[model samples]
Target: MRERVNQDVILGALALLFGCFIALYWAPIDSDTGIAEKVRSRWSIGDALAPTVAGVVIATSGFFIALGGILRGTKSTLSAKNLTYLIFFLVIVFSGFLTMRYAGPIIAGALGEEYRVLRDERPWKYIGFILGGGGMIFGLMSLAEGRISLRRLILALLIAAALALIYDLPFEDLLLPPNGDV
Candidate 1:
């Protein structure tokens, strides 16, 4: 068990370190190619940019998660490690569309400026994010924190959906994700 924990921590950390270097070099592309740039005729993301950042983010998350597992040692009853892996994988897969749809408003908010995306909602996109993501998040939590039961799973899923709704609905009038329907 200890050996496994050490392996997971070390491997995850190495992956994250590699990804950090990749992102460090590539993350700047967005600023270089964004609307403010007059260097190119039009704004365009370099092909390497998105994947690099995503890799970095995933690696970073994986590191923390692995390290967390190491810290917890062996808690056999309900293990969410696999679930964590799945959620992280899904997030990395979706990060591109998620970033494009949500980063602007997030950045603007951080900068204390008003911003809006053309539409803050999209049917399929919203549905997938809410339902699919919610399930994963809740399922992970279920597996991690306590015993999993039908009632617990339902409750967790509901909580996840509600959390998404809270973020989506309250912000509709103010700021919505780029793909979020107005």
Candidate 2:
């Protein structure tokens, strides 16, 4: 009997190596600023912060995935079903993003207001983020559970609201997606 390489192990190893390379070398060399810095007595994120955090997260996820594969002792292969799920997931995510980007502008336009001008204001700013983000949560949950429920919709909206608050309240300078673009 021949031993087959576990897909998780191979994928995880590649991710781990890629993440390490990014975090250790690419970010430091490419970025002009450090991950964080104090500017005029205010702490702020620098150019490298996003890439560094992403790398760390990828490495951590890879470590756990590899460990799980090792412990499970099962060979898993990517199949057509997995590809179908991936496509579905991508579609859902892109749809959600499109909603997030356009919902505010469309609603504002319908209400005879300009999104770019009113983006910083209350209600307007939260509209797209909450609706689109909630929709995303609802979609993903429905996809996973193979059913859509009112309860899930409510929960997803609440979670999205909380996330909007979390992002909005802390960073005064930060602009939500599409807001920056608009």
Candidate 3:
């Protein structure tokens, strides 16, 4: 019998390498600020903080995944079904992102206003994020459950709204996706 390589091992190794690259090379080169900075006698997070932390987390997770697969002697391999699911996921995510990017502008234009101007305004600012984000959540949940439910739809919308509020409320300076671009 031909010995099949474990998919988890491969995926974990790739993730570990990618994460290490991000944490070591990409983040340092791309970011203007260090992971942490001292500004006016106070320590603060810098632009590199998020990517560096994410990289470390990815690397750590990958290492554990690889270890787990090795210890379990699992021979799991990718299947056509997995590929289909991945493609579906990508489609759903991209659709949501497209909606997030364009919905605000389209709606603003319909209202006889430029999105760039209204991107900072209330209700107007949240239109795209809420719709697109909610759609993404709903779609993902539906995919997972293999069916759609009114409860899921409502929960998705509420989650998106709550996320918008959480991000927008505390951080006055932050711009949601596509807002900065527009």
Query: How good is model 2 by TM-score?
Result: 0.59
lDDT of 3 by residue, 70-121 (tens): 7775666778799999999999999999999999999889889888888889
In model 3, what are the clashing residue pairs, if there are any? none
- In angstroms, the error of model 1 at 7 is 10
Sequence-dependent TM-score of model 1: 0.31
lDDT of 2 at 166: 92
Q: Which candidate achieves the best lDDT against the true structure? A: 3
C-alpha lDDT of all candidate models, in order? 0.57, 0.88, 0.91
Which residue pairs come into collision in candidate 1? 119-180, 120-179, 120-180, 120-181, 121-179, 121-180, 121-181
lDDT: worst 10-residue window of model 3: 1-10
What digit string (tens of lDDT, one per residue) describes model 2 on residues 1-182? 21386778877888898899899999988999989989999999999989998999998888888787777754556866999999999998988899999999999999998898999998899888888888999999999999999999999999999988899999999887768888
Per-residue lDDT of 24 in model 1: 66
Descending-lDDT candidate ranking: 3, 2, 1
